[model samples]
Target: MPPVEEETVVFRSRFNRILAAVFWVVCAAALVAIGLTYAYRPTGSVAGLAVGSVLIGVAVLVVLWRPQLTVSDDAIVVRNVLSTIVVPWNALIHVDTKYALTLITPQRKVAVWCAPAPGATAALRASRAQGTQARAWTAASDLRPGDLAGTESGRAAFLVRSRWNTLREQGRIELGTAGDQRVQVQPHVASIAGLVAGVVAVALVTILL
Candidate 1:
């Protein structure tokens, strides 16, 4: 037998915790200022003032502290507010999407608790450089989460599916469901949109109130 090609690389979803934190901080500060200004205003009601202040504070904390997802060459990791889980590819038996991507493994099925995975992060990075086909594997965007289940190198494929399932639950999970057995992971704009809308609402209320 001749030499075999192989593609081995680890990939991770981006973390928005810092951005979330900053957003919350700014909102909180603005809300506090507004609350204080209105607290003593002759035209403001005590109930309205109190409600706005409390809601602003709580929203800041909650929005700023959501979960995150981590990926690697052999596993899909989910880090939530209170826990972290690492799922191996082999354990992932089925991967489906609905309200979110659901991962069914031999052990059990669990929701992913992290930010959505970006489209082709690994493939984009990999393509930027030139290397062997690494087992003659095609571009990742051309592979589906289920197709890998039947392969000898299905480990990585399994992880990708698990990650997709996890993301599906979060919101609109974008995957290129094209070709015979190919699934393309696409960037999800809804996650960012939600975050922005939430921040803007809080900020505007804080500043204008």
Candidate 2:
């Protein structure tokens, strides 16, 4: 038996990660400010505000920092806002980036939230900044904005498609396996529950104030 060699890649929105980093700094400062304010003049409203602010900040961080996709030779783990999708390469039928980086399988279509298709303005900027070049895995027009190699969705889709094509050509993906396999989709129940709780706490604090 031979060891499985792996080359894993993780992708996230650069803008979102930067925003999360900035928000984390703001949260740290807010905590310090709240602590100082509480020490100086202990008040119930101040306590309420602190609690609400913490809850709100944490909820915001989860939204900003958590969405990502991890790719390996075997599968792709897509961590969306509300759910996660595990897509094995054998189960994939095609890749599409109409709205986002999407995986089409026999069972369903799964969208990768982190790799959203660039809007017209963003796409135009990308095209001008880096020429609208067609990726190696695709023969579509260079002007196909969503399929252009410069955009986020296009980049992710290219990785997925390239890997799939390699496996297909090498005969690693079994012919009948697609019908037998299903991609796993799981909801982020705990995260969702905590977010809901935070929202309720914020609402209660707001009402009290």
Candidate 3:
């Protein structure tokens, strides 16, 4: 029997933009550092100049080359320098934050890492409670659950959670074990970065020598 598929909302956080920007800046700095080191050193060691130039050039290319993610009705696509992946909603048996969890489908699973530890959870809860209390001192108190839960964002989260629970009940998703079906999440990106970095390093070395 063909598996019954349901529509899924692929939610992406806005923080990725900030992360990309930071990475780009770092790449540029690394490149510039290599160029400067080659030009200014007292002892013109050809070997040092070659190595530095390569490192800097590679850094520049990595920053300039950015990867993007896209969402559609049928699948979530991740585009990187080396490769692209199209994971269908039906195939995505689960989605969890990075760390200690694996999204499982009947056919495959994705490994997640670096999730928040228990201490982080407790701190967040305490901070939220403190913020709520502080806000209650003013007339414009935070919106109560009744007011917000009916709103679109709140409702969406509720629906997603409910559906995820349903999937858990159906034995489609599990909490532990990295599944056997190993999918390379970003093969193309890694390959491209490595190649570009290598070429840039070689170019820098030639220029300095």
Q: In terms of TM-score, which candidate is stronger, 1 or 3? A: 3
Q: Candidate 1: which stretches are off by over 4 Å?
A: 1-14, 39-50, 53-57, 63-92, 95-102, 106-109, 119-209
Clashes of 1: 12
Residue-level lDDT of model 2, residues 26-60, one tens digit each, is 87788789889989987767777788668767776
RMSD to the true structure for each prediction, in A, is 13.3, 3.4, 9.6
Going through the candidates in the order shown, the clash numbers are 12, 0, 7
User: Per-candidate TM vs. native?
Assistant: 0.37, 0.82, 0.43
- CA displacement after TM-score superposition, residue 172 of candidate 3 (Å): 18
* Candidate 3: 10-residue stretch with minimal lDDT: 110-119
CA lDDT of 44 in candidate 2?
66
State how far residue 58 of model 1 sits from its true place (Å).
Answer: 2.9
Candidate 2 wrong stretches, greater than 4 Å: 1-6, 33-45, 132-143, 206-209
Q: Encode model 1's per-residue lDDT on 1-209: one tens digit a residue.
A: 53232234342222445666666677667667767776677333433444455555554444435454456434556544334566654455565432234455655565553323224443344433334453235444454322332221233335565555555554333343311222223333455555456666655655555
